[model samples]
Target: MACTQMNCSKNGTTSAADLTDDLIIEILSLLPVKSVCRFKCVSRLWYLLISQHRKRLPQTISGFFYPKHRYNNEDGLIGFPTFDGISGDQKQLFPDSSLPFLTGYRQILPKDCCNGLIFCLCWKDSPIDEADYVVCNPATEEWVVLPDAGHKSDALAYRLGFDGAMSPHFHVFQILEGDEDYGYISGVNIYSSETGVWSYKENGWGDNEIQIVDMRGVFFNGMMHLLTCEFKILAVDTEGKTWRTISLLETMCVGNICLGPLAFIGQSQGRLYFINMRDNDSSKLSVWILEDYNGNEWIFKYSISTSQLFGKLFGEKDHMLQRDYADLLLQRDYALVAIHPECNLIFFVWRCKDVLLSYDMDRGKVCVICSLKYHLYDTFPPYLPYVPSFLRIGKPRVEA
Candidate 1:
């Protein structure tokens, strides 16, 4: 707390050369990274302090708070409402589902989650009317939107990714829809919180004419994975302006196996697993491992005939929402840990509710972690990871 001063009264006459780098970094830690970044423009000392600590700031914050949480930071992507309609745009914390205090995040779409913040994009008209792309922290309820990346076309694709290194960083890849031959192609623009502006460039290979655009970005294997199509997974490098593809499931292996939609299964122990459910209209189910983001290997696992997890996984039921419920999610441990009310009409009487399960990455099998209404198998006790929705004070520091 004493690392940072209230006003940093050392701005004007005090030459930053007089202060040791360690002391400068310490001061920045006492304050929020966002604040340090904002103050970087003041002088070289301030800039160094802010830039030098940008990499360590997130770690510092995570270390400080991860242990403090009942669920810690090892759980899956915590789902919570970003926009409140019933509460009239209120950012107040509530306990209906996710952590009560995990609110105030803008454009809360499931694109990419890193460290402690989630990134999203919002687009529309202009200045007084134009929308924005936001990267935010639900825990601290902090958010920052990106500036436009010189796009002339209305169609655009924003993919957020993270790179793991000494200075692990998160970046957004924005692909503007434009002509590639006539040179109107607005390449993948990069945006970093540490470096606020989006670097303009040209579109990379296989990054054009994407028929299926999956807004749900999966950060896996040191790259960002997005379901580009049933046969391809677009992987973007978070550190560089390069985009590539990674094979999830081979088309020749299972005749007509398609890549399922991606969702955060959970990040237990030390791995980040993506839950993808594949359903068939022939009254059958299949689940595949979407590969864990941040892992060190290219492991693609699949579960065929997954009728065990979600009863009635195929046939007419699978084709219900051709596009809506395209695939089923293999909810894993610590994920879907709480009550998830969605998709009614399960087993004719039991409503379709989200449940927790243990996924065998090696065997493609799923074991229920909680009890279901119909006792899909057997009634298991629910897990209470810290009481939901308790007003924990802010991170003990705040300033505009």
Candidate 2:
């Protein structure tokens, strides 16, 4: 029997097989992000449809990538970058963590990750000045080697800024160090993907005394926010036309010391967050959110102690062992790795124990995620939070 297409819907119902790709995408877009991610496993077609339309749908953090250093007999010092997946289905989007597409480089050191793009310093076998700044997207395997910025690598602090939902273009900022002061920022070199050129601006920040404390900066609300030694947030836009500074809470300041602040800045759920240890008490960690962006007001959101975090993990410890553990906690041996983009989960690395742990601010619970492979020495390794995006960067390249 030759049944007509219109006759098949006589009962006002459509079969699963009869649904078109666009129809399925429309339905998936209405579901929660978790449900939309689960549909990826329903079929290969569903995976492709969702991935293609990911920017329109809500996005969540997939995992994190941090450098793991090892001494190879042949290569001397080498970095083996590792990825720790937090989402099951999303992890499948990036099969290879090594980033094999970035070829012909002695080593690739990831400097910063904003949105879905990673900014890396690709060291060549030639002189240090000949190194290249490479930005790559793992999901699409698209990469682009940027033109030289005409500045020495040693004197520059590089940061990547991209927001796929807001715009397709991305920017790279190279902050230059002052020649005489050495601590103050002398100038800035910005590269725009849309213009495909580098632009220079000399210390638009206006305050030469406020030195950049950390190389990592948080990109939020169309501005790159950097923590300064003065315990203030310095922000600059892509055009270098507008500049703003938000003062940190007076209690968080470590006043006039050469040491960097024990604080980190990150963005989650459309707000800027600052996490730092209490200056008076190192064991107490405080989380603050910029509730009023225009007014520059920071509201204290959560606070937790070292005992509350690691107490359940180490139960019924001996007196001697407990004493040693308390000493380690007092010394602040943990490093804050990342903050969940969608929730109140904070990820940190316990250097002394070499384990990754996540603390839930809402539930007041702490859980160990996994053990780290590489041994961390004096300095903490760069832990970059990654949100998977199917956005294409440059021209697609063949898999290496």
Model 2 ranges off by over 4 Å: 1-56, 87-95, 125-130, 152-156, 179-182, 253-261, 318-324, 330-332, 375-377, 395-400
**What is residue 270's positional error in candidate 2, in angstroms?**
1.0
Model 2 pairs in collision: none
lDDT of each: 0.40, 0.75
In candidate 1, which residue ranges exceed 4 Å CA deviation? 1-112, 120-130, 163-168, 179-186, 239-241, 252-304, 312-351, 354-400
Encode model 1's per-residue lDDT on 1-400: one tens digit a residue. Answer: 2325432344444445557778777676556434665777988867776675554442311110110112215333332222211122222332232323323332123344454445543433233234556655554454565666665664455665543332334577665657644323245566665566666656565445553333345455555555544455556565546667545443321112122122223232234333333323322332333344434344543443434434433345555443334223332211222111111101101123433244444444444433322222122122222111111222312234
lDDT computed for candidate 1: 0.40
The residue-level lDDT of candidate 2 at 21 comes to 72
Q: Return the top candidate by TM-score.
A: 2
Model 2 lowest lDDT segment of ten: 253-262
